[model samples]
Target: MVQLDATTQEVLNRISEEFAQKGAYNLRQNGVALCHGDSEHIKIRKKEDKPGIDILIDGDTKGERVFIPVVVSVSGMTDLVYNDFYVADGADVTIVAGCGIHNSGCNESRHDGIHTFHVGENANVKYEEKHYGEGNGTGSRVLNPVTNIEVGRNSVFTMDTAQIKGVDSTVRETNVELAEGAKLYVLEKLMTDGEQKAESNIEVCLEGSGSSAQIVSRSVCKGHSLQTFHPKAVGRNKCHAHIQCDSIIMDQAHVGSIPEIQAEHVDAAIIHEAAIGRINDEQLLKLRTLGMTEAEAENVIIENFLS
Candidate 1:
């Protein structure tokens, strides 16, 4: 196990709490990496040619699921990390990864991460990631992330990502490809306050027979924040795809949801839906009847809606 200072530990704890990370984990501060875990079924190693780590899950592994958590905390610096994951056939694993910025410096802090996943036949993978920022300084906290996923035949992949608060700006892009009998599910949640801005673009391709993909996005924008969500699903064969986007905007906040569904084959099927609005008055009034203040009631409603 690697020892961490008080400030770094606090950042890790926040990341853990937000993403529900437990058990085996890895921590990276500034640009240094520290990892601790069992090596029998899960292997984590730094990449000699890159600035990040590689996680490998052995083949034919079952029973207890493997968990890998990664955290990055830095201030007044731009950090870049590249993570590659390989899951062998019939393996099941979960990964929790996030980044937090603790900036009390004069310069802005930022993090850019690229993640790629290779899932083998009959494997199942669940991945979750969250981003947060906190500081009393005048520096901006920015994050940009790119994800690429490839799932083999009969495999399943689920990805959940959330950016709850404290980020100044972020742009996220995700691309996924599914083989025969493979399934991909994506859930994206985001909340932005202050003058923060966020943009997310996701594309999924169902290229094999029996392949399916679904994407659901939820977002809340407050205090002049701006957000945009674009999710596209393409079916190239006898497959199914669906996309849904929902958002809430308040206090001059702006949000846009654009979903595209394309069917390239006669047997392909695709559907999409989008909705954007504010807090429901009935929901708020019902909460207020419980002796809560207006602000408190709104908060409760928003939390429930996002959850």
Candidate 2:
């Protein structure tokens, strides 16, 4: 294993703990790939023409989860990476991916990552990714991520993505296609403070009979930040799909939620819901009665709501 600097190590720890990465692991810093684990069922290697990693999970493999962490600790740098994941037929696996940036300089730092997943028949995959940024300097922290997923017949795919704090700007896009009897579930959580801006767009297609999908997104905007969310689901067969978007807006912030559902077949069913509001005064009052400060009470409420 390769050694990391103190600052880089701290950033990695914040994203994923060391003990949680007992299986296959890959660590990347500032567009450079380093420190990858070796496993028979899981394979991780660098791309031939890009600063990225390719991960492959063998068929019928079921055991510990795979962990991959990417971090950028320098300022004035733009990093781009492309990750491709291939899961074999009848395999069951879990993947944990974390990306973080620690920029303490006057220049802006940004990361753009594109991920594509190919899930085979009867396979099940659970994927989790978190994004975070921390710095005291005047630089902007930005992240742009795009994901594409293809699920085979009778397979299941679930994804959970979260962005906690300190990111100045972000644009996230996701697309998924489901085959016969395939299922997909996606959960997204986001928080923006200061003058940050974020935009998220998701599209799912149920192309085969008995395919189903569900998408849920929650966001909090504070301190003049701006956020926009768009979720669209299309059912082309006798499938079911649902989408929900919820947001909390505070302190001169702005948030917009747009959800669209389309059913091409007579037996298809699709629904969507969206809600945007601020913290409840009744809840805040109850917390204040417990001897908690206003700020602390608000924080508690936000944490609980997001959780």
Candidate 3:
């Protein structure tokens, strides 16, 4: 692994210790190491106007594990991109990605990120991603991640992701394609508590026989911020798809959810349901009478519904 700065190196060291304690698989790329079967710190490196890293498949027929942690300290019109992560046949892999930014005082600091993954036949992959940002500058950070997953026959994939408040972020899209007998499970979550904008777009396709996909999403929008969720799932012949999205609004915030499911074949079964509403005053009043303040009551609603 490349030697990291003190702060990042400490995160990596902690992950390494956890790996030893849990007996997990270790993955190394360009000297950077990550562990499977155990959680590890995300890998973050500074890339000046270029693709950060690319993973390729060769020689080995088995899959590999990867961990990515990104810290955006760039200021003044910065750009960064990365190539796709490749997974080969008859193997299983896991990826844990984390993104965050420091308190840069620049007014025009922004970051753009892209991640792509390819899954091969009979392979299984589990991916988890988290985004966090905290700063007091007028500069806003943007995150546009593209997840291109091609699941081969009998392959299984799962995704769990969460986005926190601070800075403006929009996930352009999450596109998934499944092969025969492939299965996928996805959980998308977002929580906003700042004076920023947030949006998420996710799409899944069941393109082969016996393929299936499911999505569960929860969102919370507060303050003067706005949020939107657009989730779509498509099922072809003999395929199955399901989607569920529920949201809660507070503090005069605005939220919109559009969930749709499309199935073309007679043997296919697709279902979608979505609901958007605000925290009722009746509920808040009831909680306030129970020794909770207005802010506390609203927080309870957010935690129970969104978290």
Candidate 4:
């Protein structure tokens, strides 16, 4: 692993300390690549024409993990990066990625990331990501991430993402395509407070027979925050897909969930579920009766809901 400064380590610790300790890892700061480490099964290389990297995972690689994390602490800085991944056939591995920002001046700090992944036949890939921001500056912390994934025949792709806390603004988008006998599952969690705003849009296309997919989202909004979610599933063959969106609203917060399904074949099966509401009064009362304040009760309910 490469040496890190205090600011970099602070942001890494907030996201995941184990990421820096991983054998295969890449760290990017400001507008440059800081350091990257490669393992026996994974190789990370900087892109020739872009401000990002290309990761190649060996075939049949098991029990291996890769970490790709970026941080922006300089105020008024805007960072954009494009990263790609190639996973060989029969490989089973996990990839961790996210961005952290801290602004200490009166200028906004923003990071935008575009990632594309290719999964080979019979491969299994699990990807995890988290976004976070913090500082006492008047500047806003902004993040926008776009992901594109292609799952090969008989392959499996699983994605889990979260917005932990302190992000001022964000727009998250994802697109996925699956081939024959492929499987996909995605779970996203988010929390916002104090005038924060977030929007998420995701679409999945099942283009081959026997393909299946499921997408689920959970979010919490508080203190004048606003959130919107759009999740869609498209079935072009004899496949099945499901989308679920759920949210909790509190203290003048606003939330909207729109789910869509499209079927192009007779044997296609698709479904969607959307629910947006606030904490239950009875649950809050019960918690309050247990010697908890209203704020504490609400926090507990929100935590459990997002969890």
Candidate 5:
């Protein structure tokens, strides 16, 4: 059994607390705190040529879960890692991953993570990731993440991502490609407060017959924060694709939503929608009438909006 430092454990609780338990996760704090595999069918190990890890899920496995989380607690530290996941054919699993940073110094703390997933034929995978930052310090908190996924024939991949905490700056990008009869679904939620800035870029390609994809994003901007979202989907065969981007703005905040869809074949179907607006007065008034303060009402709306 392995143990996590108090500070690191506290931060891990913000994202995937249950996986922080020993013998249940592959966790890295500042460096490799602990790394282990779930079973013979599942393996976790370092990348001999790189600074990250590789997760291998065996074929025909059913009803399994894996967690790999990272945390950074040192001020003035910048970390970069590349992780890869390989899911074998006919397997169904859920993967939980996230990064949390706790910095308390005069220098900036930043983390950049690149993840790539290969889903084999007929495999079904659900992936979730969250980002958080907390500290009382003069330094800034920053997180940038890049994800690439290749879904094989008849496979399905679903992704959920959220970042609603004290990050000062972030740029997130996701790219996906679907094979014959494959499907890709995504739901993204974000919140930016104070002077934080966030940018999201998503692109997907439905390149095989019967392949389909859908992407949706919801974000809230408060104070002087800024956020921008770009979602694009392309259909290259007898496939379907849709993209949607929506956001809420408040108190000197700014938001931009850009959605695009393209069809390259006569049988390809694609559509897109985008909207940005402020908090609805009617919604706020209703909450306030229930004896909640204006600020409290706004908070409630923001929380539900992101959810």
Candidate 6:
């Protein structure tokens, strides 16, 4: 079995100590990874193959929290999977997950992911995710992600995702769940350029009275690429939901946002909003009139928007 580097080993050690202080936990070096907690049914596996990195998450844990670290580099083509990390009843847990790619080597890559969360009554969970890519290579990337959440009465679940740049990339997915007397919030962002494309399908269904859900999304597409965002909200009796998506386009780039709202009960209230547009040409002309070159004008806009 291959061992982790000194830096990774130190990180594992720190997490293990933290687990011990909470009592009734164990930590050990598994083949190619580290394991923590006395979790029997839960499993995290990482494998390296020609296509790229492969990860597997199985079952739920009874612990207070669960943590997993993933790193992958693909010079050719790759595909990956992320199973849902389950949260036990009346237990609070946090899942911090991130993904990065060696954009220079790989010609193409795709990420296939699914997250199933079981929120117990009166429990709370915090989930965060980050995705970024780099390299000058020309290829295509597809990210298909699905999140299934079941929130018990009076529980809370929050999910956030940040996606950086990619060329000729496409992302599509769905998020759905049932919340009773609880609350759910989702925040997502995407940035892209150069023939890139991203599509996301999001939906939230409220089944419990007094339950609420909010969805917020922002995106930027530049250099002839296309970006699309679709968000839907459905409310039942005495439930409420909100959905919104915003986007900016540049240099023949294209962006589209679709927001849908459905209220089945008269007691329910739902709202949906969407907006997409490109930078102002007259503003750039004004910059040029002020002695700034065309290139400089565009650069200024990018710096102001991204920085």
Please state the error at residue 257 of candidate 6 in Å.
Answer: 1.2
TM-score of 6: 0.73
Q: Pick the candidate with the highest lDDT.
A: 4
Worst 10 residues of 6 by lDDT: 23-32
TM-score of each: 0.94, 0.97, 0.79, 0.97, 0.97, 0.73
Candidate lDDT values, in order: 0.83, 0.89, 0.67, 0.91, 0.88, 0.62
Deviation in Å, model 5, residue 5 alpha carbon: 1.5
Candidate 4 lDDT by residue in tens digits, 1-307 = 5678888888888876677655888888998888788898899999999889999998968968899989998999999999999999999999999899988889999999999999999999999898999988999999999999999999999999999798999999899999999999999999999999999999899998999999999999888999999888999999999899888888899999988899999999998998888789999999999999999999898888877
Give the clashing pairs for model 4: none
Q: Candidate 1, clashing residue pairs?
A: none
Clashes of 5: 0
lDDT of 1 by residue, 257-280 (tens): 878888899999999989999899
Candidate 2, residue 82: lDDT: 94
Q: How many times do residue backbones clash in model 3?
A: 6
* Residue 63 CA displacement from its true place in model 6, Å: 12
lDDT of 4 at 96: 90
After superposition, which runs of candidate 5 have C-alpha atoms over 4 Å from their true positions?
22-24
Structure candidate 2, residue pairs in collision: none
Model 6 lDDT tens row, 159-201: 8876765535656576666667889988887787876777878
**Ten-residue region with minimum lDDT total, candidate 5:** 17-26
Task: Flag clash pairs in model 6.
Answer: 51-78, 75-106, 84-116, 103-134, 103-135
Candidates 4 and 6 compared: the better one by TM-score is 4
The alpha-carbon lDDT assigned to residue 201 of candidate 6 equals: 82
